[model samples]
Target: MAQTGTAGPASIATGPVTITEVVQSALRDYPQIHVSQEEFNASVANIRLARTAYLPRVDGLAQVNRATRNNIFGTLLPQNTIPSISGPVIGSNNGGSVWGSATGLLVSWQPFDFGLRHANVKAARAAKDKADASVQRSQLEVTTAAADAYLTLIAAKQIEKSAAAAVDNWDVLLRTIHALSSAQLRPGADESRIEAELAMARTQLVYARQADESGRATLVKFLSRTGDINTSLDTGRLLSELPPGGDEEVPFQTADHPVMAEQRANVAQSAAQLRATERSWVPQFNVEGAAYARGSGAEVDGHRLPGANGLAPTVQNYAAGVNITFPFMDFASIHAREAAQAATLRANQANEQLADKALQEQFAKAQAALRAAREVAANTPIEVKSAHMAFDQAKARYQAGLVPIDDLAQAQRLVVQAEIDDSIARLNVWRALLQFDAARGNIQPFLQAVNK
Candidate 1:
């Protein structure tokens, strides 16, 4: 795990920030992290709602109306397109208007549904787990990105440092050749050649500086800051040696890795959903108690009630019953839903398997690349040492009038290349380590190793 950094990346201090600090800061406020967190919170709310199904529900209603009262005997189909009225047949029709009002409350509780409510709650919990895994995956992705940006800036700075050194060396050689030519010892061609070499070295320096600037801008973007201002970094220690354990293999543990865990959660969620669907068609057993009142403008003997006589709930009744009902004709739809949910569960399982396979392949590639980078990093110092020795000998010979300036220039080019290679070789290993950690679905372990 990464230690917490400052409050935010926007308020960068003058001192160099560590990679872990930068990444941890971004993790604190990155939009994706918050989005996933909110999703997890929503899933938690859903779990609460699902569990509410296990509790009793109470509803209250109150209404007042003035409408014409009439009587009829024929039955009408059960539907809501038209209003419903309840009264006995009067054997005669009349139209009269009066006030009516009523108020009531009903409480219904499902003593049990076998296990449907429990299965639904279980599915909600599984969904919450999936969302949590998604949050972890988002965090890991952000960490990987920050590591890439920071390392890119460091590598660019390394190249820029080497290019600047080459320019300085070439400029000094040019001045020496000019002085020697003026003293009538070296040829004028030596002065011209050294000048051209210095120009090329300066050009290389310009490109390296540009790269460094671009990389710094990217780093700034990742730091959640808004500007192209060149950010200063303390990369000296990072360039001095390979990170610990860069050459060795880390255990390719993936069961708890965020990617695998997220996929596994997906499978679990699907399985829970399937279970919920399977338990859905069971008999619905509910215990219901209702206390209600009725108000009617028409009397039972076909006479209109007096003014305001039915305006309030003057007649009330209480009823309670244990009702057991089943959707006898719902077999087809329930079967279809069950089949679809089962298929979804199977697909999620397959997806989990695929994620596992992909992770394994990616880990293998990362290991191979790390091995190659470590080997190159191990050998670049020798190349730098040999090139520097050759350049020194060539310079001595050129000054002693035993060799041409071209030979010394060639040796200088080799030394410059060797120096650049040496720095880049180490950075390459760091990048490889970054990939290794990314493939492992987390970067904290690598950050801890590097920072240590």
Candidate 2:
């Protein structure tokens, strides 16, 4: 529920973008999200396939062939491609070739399977549900990752800015010390010390810039973008957004979480599979019907029929019957049932373990982290303000020859450290809130809170 910013016409906008926009872009283009969506679609197809067992299977058949109308006492290979003569077996060999055609339609319906088909369909549905949960889980993961990268980039930028500011301040101090040393009011050693401090500040700025660049690269990767990209993030607004109350705990239901839902669905699917395997021993009832007409090239008494007449339907037949099959000695079925039962038990145990242990530990850790981050964020601004005042007083005193260069340098370092700490503290609170939401298997609530 992070606030969505209006995007410009460009592929990569130049202005500040909100956290919500980055997450939206990632959700839209990330490969993992697309892959999970396709998997869910495949699961839907599987469900359809399983339901097809409840419907009748109808097939159409037609054949035309030309062969010598001869039946001998010798054996013949049984193959559809190798046409055979349709005539009564005879002691003498007399044959003639003619064309013949046959056509038929067959329907087979498993009218009942004693709940076996139903169980299979139910299992398929459960699998589909699990796949749906996987899609949600994938989205949550991608969103969380994108948000994290974005926050890290923001923190890096702040660090770079603070470093640059420190460099500028030290440069000014170096110039002041140089002028004082030229006038012999401050020692040359003080000027040299300030110069060294300035050099160190510049080096720190370079490192900060490198970190910033690396963070931007990671953010771009999360957004699924290639090549050079420039991101202008709404860092000020994001940092300003505060949590409702430091002591109030966020409400979360583990059972309703996507991870738990997925595991529960897995258990359900396994149970259904076990039920299906158990029902495999039940009697299976099927109804089959077929109607066919065929033309023969030879008479029943081994005489060849005339040319064109053999191509016409000379015989017609139809049959309908009910079949009931009971597996009386199916060792395979027994073993399969046992395996399915074991799998079902394993799935149940996994779900139970996650719900009882993993989820609770994660929730507790997130809560603790959020609380600590909030406390640090709340205290950092005061530290920064005090450090800034001290640095200003130290600089004024050093220029008046009332304080040593070491004291002044220490004050400057304190200011820079305080600024860095303040920036990190603010971002850490956001990161902790994100972790808290992720532990609950969703980020929507966190986004809503932050955006508000």
Candidate 3:
């Protein structure tokens, strides 16, 4: 039978809460989970930004300038530090100032980019997918951690209960020994031994309470709570009930894991970037159109215009042209393409080598731990039963003056240890199950089973 004890302040919740509820609460309220959600939103925005490249760019322009209509012929240095002459010396002089106004509507559209824009869009989408995987991964990690902390707190509380029960049992034995010693039926040495045992049991209870407090604190931290609030776990259900489907072997696949999915997305993104870089060497074609009306004081044939005409629309121009740019002599494009190719190769290698190896190792370890915990959980009930029987027999013998105080104390200690071990064994099985789900890169299925 399991004993119960109060280790801290009263819990705020009215009834016992399930592990699934705790995990859900953490996922909903935890700051770390919110951060991942925001990052996913940012990644979505980045995809929209990349898609903007597919649309035509339109710009509005208006400018007004006042300058002297002067002409000069001289060798002027390009540097800003050197000044140049401005008055006309080779042509007829038009030495007057005028205000010129210009307005235009310009549109530039990349009619063909040789798949460069498409690759950029694809890469951005891949990045968004990777961010989505990251959000899932974050949820899994936080949920698993919260579940572990809850189990630890539950185990610690069970230990504290057992310790408190042991202390109570020792106190009863001490009273009995004291009464017998007073009546000369038991030796004074027996009374002293019982007192020592009672003190040790009390000390153990103190340590157990400390452990419970520490475990509760960790659980509260996982829940992101402020201050030191007491928690009450559903101690009635210390062991996890198996799902209706029973404990069948769960299939493990590395490719389906979130970590692997994120890496795969990264590789895809790298490949898209490499494609974009390779297409950089291809010629880009664009269609540009502009309509503008300008006013000028000087004419092309050395004729001077009036001030009023300078502010009027004296010149109108409309242009429509196709532009083709080929960076044939740019060595930088070649080097950049090579760099992107190397990154793609590295991403592929990491996905195959590092991620695969880590996933395999995690799966193996979780499986082994699950097996060991199951075995221990199955056997601990028998151990507890035998220990209970032994302790009862020893108590009977001690009452009948057939066993010494030392033997009775030893039996009591065994009972206490057995209870603690049984509690811990059951909790370990739950922890092992949690690790198994985590190794698979998602905990939702495991959580659903437990919640059921």
Candidate 4:
């Protein structure tokens, strides 16, 4: 027995419902969903790396040495000559070893170099900004795609329901024809015609199911998910109430468009790159130093004595100096790079313009589709009623033997066509709604309005 105060299986809601919910769920499970956030984080890391340029750098040093005494020659001496230690001799003997080592720290800072460092930092910052903007654009695209997929699923579900209803209506008409025949008022040929119509309706139902399944598959793929699309969609919630008003406006403003924002960022980045390149012609300055110990030597007749006077090791020395570098050539390459960046900037500008124009056209198209859909939906009820009345008149006349079964079948066909038309009109309204949502951003606000 079912538990008291417990909900039944039929009451449970399944899968994604709201667009926001769908997006959130898909992102939570899909690895590819984080591309935009990852891109933004990467840009932040690059910016941090670039900022390291402003900080001074320090390093350590170490080393070891070995001595050899194999024919170690020194300054040349005369063939045979005895000379005093203070005399101007031409030669010396070499045979000694020195054990010395030292360690020190070195630091360098860009004290001043025209504008080289500044330009590098500026370029890095521009690139970081561009990366950030790209992330935003990617995020917008994902959101739009998610919303579109969800809406498409909803539309397919609605069409399936319409097809099912159409089949049911045809079944009812067929049953009515049987009843009339039993009363001896309708021709037996009418039953055959109605059966044919029923078969057609079933075929349509099969096609509708296939279309709905195809739409669900597309939605799942777009969300980057793994699921059985045939069973994933929530048919029960397919026609959940839409925005209260049958009409809604299409947005035309571009202040929030991600593609436009990305283009603008590209332009700024390119401009900054150009500025950096222009500054590359400037000079750069750095300071360096080294220190060591030193020693002296003595001599004998045409030869220097080994460890003469016990002074065999060399003294260490210390040196410090500054270096300055300025580009004297490569101006041609620099100019070419600047030209390329300028061209990229122009291209980005053109892209921005194109995005604006595309937005305008999309806005107009969405508006037209929405308006047409509303008109069709508003008049569908009257069309359905008119078709029903015509079908009833034809049925009654045929039952009285005053009209042919073919005429009645034609009238029934008109009724079915009208029903199909109404269903298509409803589907079109939803399609238009989805398109408008894409153009404006998302349908969250509209959904909220409808709920309110």
Answer with 2 or 4, whichever has the higher lDDT. Answer: 2
Candidate 2 error regions (>4 Å): 1-15, 72-86, 183-189, 221-231, 325-330, 333-337, 344-348, 389-407
Scored by TM-score, the top model is 1
Question: Positional deviation of 233 in candidate 1, in angstroms?
Answer: 1.7
Tell me the spans in candidate 1 whose CA falls farther than 4 Å from its real position. Answer: 1-12, 91-95, 172-203, 224-231, 392-410
Q: lDDT tens string, model 4, 130-245?
A: 66666655555665666667767766666677778878887988898899888877777778888998898899889989887787666665443344344454423224333344
lDDT of 2 at 208: 95
After TM-score superposition, the amount by which residue 204's alpha carbon in candidate 4 deviates from its true location, in angstroms, is 1.8
How high is the CA lDDT of each candidate model? 0.84, 0.81, 0.77, 0.64
Worst 10 residues of 3 by lDDT: 1-10
Candidate 4, residue 113: Cα displacement in angstroms equals: 3.7
Query: 343-391, model 2: which lDDT tens digit per residue?
Result: 7669686766767578878889999998999888989989999999999
Of the two candidates 3 and 4, the one with more favorable TM-score, higher being better, is 3
Q: What is the TM-score of each candidate against the true structure?
A: 0.86, 0.85, 0.82, 0.75
Q: Which residue pairs collide, candidate 3?
A: none
Displacement of residue 192 (Cα, Å) in model 2 is: 3.8
Model 2 poorest 10 in a row by lDDT: 1-10
